[model samples]
Target: MSTEPTASGHEAASPAVDPPAWLQRIKSNYCRVCGSPLKLLKPDGEREWRHVCGSCGYVDYHNPKLVVGCIVEHEGKILLCRRAIEPCRGLWTLPAGFMELNESTAAGAARETWEEANAAVKVLAPYAHWDIPVIGQAYILFRAALAPPYTFSSGSESLEVALFAPESIPFDQLAFSSVSITLRLYLEDLRAGTFRLHHGVIDKRPGSQPNDPGAFVVRDHMALELGGASATAAGPGVQEQ
Candidate 1:
């Protein structure tokens, strides 16, 4: 969906909308394991419909993919790539892509940076993670620095690659929601001279169409969200210890 570049902070409203392209469902006709036509079934004790094979009993799971990326800082600038492919072609974004098999998240992040930016990086730590339920993707980004003899060029998937200072970042022309959120938060931390893990959700705005980029809401920390409890809370299974 078409939208103006969102500002630097949390949006006011976040309404869950139907996922584009039916992301929550598997559209493939054949099972990956046995090449048999798949059937949608809940299976015994399963809650969600899964594509399962009656012949091989192979269950096709539609798990959310991990899109790993890096916020590589060199000479106080962050690396970005200009896409040469569709789905936001010609837009600038962090060096990221889908994680590959048999690799750790950090390794995948590093690999993506190299593949798209032609830059070798040393990952420092986990920096941010954002869940986009609308597209069934969870972004795992990292803090990194350019490795020895820092140099870069555009890869096959990128039309160009470059570094941008915080003030010079192309906020309005970022390719994806995840990239914008990562860069904005990174810049905030840079100004504060402190770094910490960030987590958030990107959900559809109320009344938004399928083509809209949706809205972002800060979720703070997952442990804080799931662990905090009320002192006076009472429920069907409540018992004071």
Candidate 2:
């Protein structure tokens, strides 16, 4: 497996196909809502094990986390941030982060763009959606254009921020497979002059064969029907219709 130096300057291994053993152990042993030990139980009509709290009978259901990001375009170049944090530090990626409470996905995408790249953008159409079951994450990516002034700086989460032409994007140094795939699809659509919504699954769980050194396996790719009206621009940190 290929490895890269993280922000701490320690060589980190590629993303695992399976959740780390520690995570599984932690999930199996406790209930977050109630201070109680948990036991595995299969509810009626369910085949999977669920953590059940013996004290409050609370079923701890683990769901995928929502991650939002944007492909911000300016003067025919795309924005990317060099991560200052771990997981894939020093590598480049689209401005993205986990969703927070009381915010729409598009709002979260725009916020992350500003937070990571210090660049304001007019959030546009949904560019991509991905389900990564193994890591328990769903990524919502949007196509956005740089708002007036077109200025940017690196935020605390980034070591540097810069723009690169589509042909100059460093695919090999991308922080995540989702970012790489999104950029590739965006560039392809840009050439075709038709940006459509892309939906897919990335299963990196064990027993699966990864297409690349990183355990990411992209599957179930297809264009989706845009069901709603076109997206509109909204003010910074505001949700769009």
Candidate 3:
């Protein structure tokens, strides 16, 4: 789509940190493909350790999960849902969820919007792509508009749903940094009359040292030149769910 300056800014890399507990649990557990115990091994020319099955030779690739969402705007208000699940219960966030297999990212975004808000939206172009290595989730966000009628209800995953004006967004109580960042950029673009694709990384490694990097950093994709690194990198750990 549009290539305008983003209000949310870019994320930068910092000192490497420890993985999350959920990922550690998966690494210590047995293989899912087979009932065999997993062992750490450097496969072929790889630098880091990988979980390999002793009996079945299954290799567990710790990849970032794909999460899809939509920025559903009706009139001038944006839709937000109060999370009913753990990790961030009762917190407000955009309509988003883990992407299922056999579905396109756009379709998944639309599905999540409908599931979380019970609202129909016309899925538009991809808007923001966030690489959340600490949580092992790569978020693909789409820019969408509310379809006709603009009625909405809270789905099972949401405790409640409502539309909020840009100036009234609850930034302090957002469920995730990605959601906050996306909304900020969207609001800024709305004011500037331009919307651009945003790419950035968010690291949420727990117990990080103070002198270490902050929880969030956004890179200037327009100014910096990436040699050839994939936007989504394989982080140190993996999460089962």
Candidate 4:
């Protein structure tokens, strides 16, 4: 995807256009405003799809979600937490979470760190990012850094938290492939004393049930998506790993 630097000079990924036939399905089945069934339209726009419902005027746009996380290092070791939830229970991952409303992206990242690891951190510049889909929700990822000498505690979703040296990273114990790749990249950067930001697309659309065109679901709060990485494949049952 071609990305142009916005006014902030941050590279923004170009939007992807879904199949036009899907747009037709959306226009015919969903009301432009409330996403309810559109009953009538005297003259629908030909160039653009538009339906104004008497109840509401909700414009639907395919928006990608933003996520954030940090690669916290201490004493030549990186921090990871074992998950206690489904999808990849008993697997290790970096501390991360979703961004909440009324909060900056960095603040959300910090909050997730505090919630998951009980550690405070300072937001660093962008590191790595990837576009991925979970069920139906699209996401973006950001890599950050943590302040040093912090202690971690087990959270509601975490079974345990600990730090591991680069050589001792537990690959088989990683919850998601994204987590494994992130750690590998981080260690590579550490060895070279250089950091590089990368972005890619990972599609994980679920299997379609016969005759259920509008059936869609999204799995959130996976460590892999913390900052926009694909946690796992889309299947009938979406889980962590």
Which predicted model would earn the best TM-score?
A: 2
- What are the runs in model 1 whose C-alpha is more than 4 Å off? 1-25, 205-241
Over 56-132, each residue of candidate 2 has an lDDT whose tens digit, in order, gives 88888777799999988777788999999987888999999999999999999999999998899988677899988
Rate residue 225 of model 4 by lDDT.
Answer: 23
lDDT against true structure, model 4: 0.57
User: What are the clashing pairs of model 1?
Assistant: 1-211, 1-212
lDDT of 3 by residue, 158-184 (tens): 999999988999887888778878888
Judging by TM-score, tell me the better candidate of 1 and 2: 2
Better of 1 and 4 by TM-score: 1
Clashes of 4: 5
* Candidate achieving higher TM-score, 2 or 3: 2
Clashing pairs in 2: none
The C-alpha stretches of model 4 lying farther than 4 A from their native spots are: 1-55, 60-62, 134-149, 204-241
lDDT of each: 0.73, 0.78, 0.74, 0.57
Candidate 4 clash pair list: 33-58, 87-240, 140-228, 141-227, 141-228
* Model 4 lDDT per residue over 136-218, tens place: 23233344445655677888889998888788999877865455666776666556544556555443434543113233321
Model 1 lDDT tens row, 40-146: 66679754456789889999878899999988888777788989987788889888889999999999999999999899998876778888775778899977788
Model 4 TM-score, 2 decimals: 0.62
lDDT of 1 at 232: 14
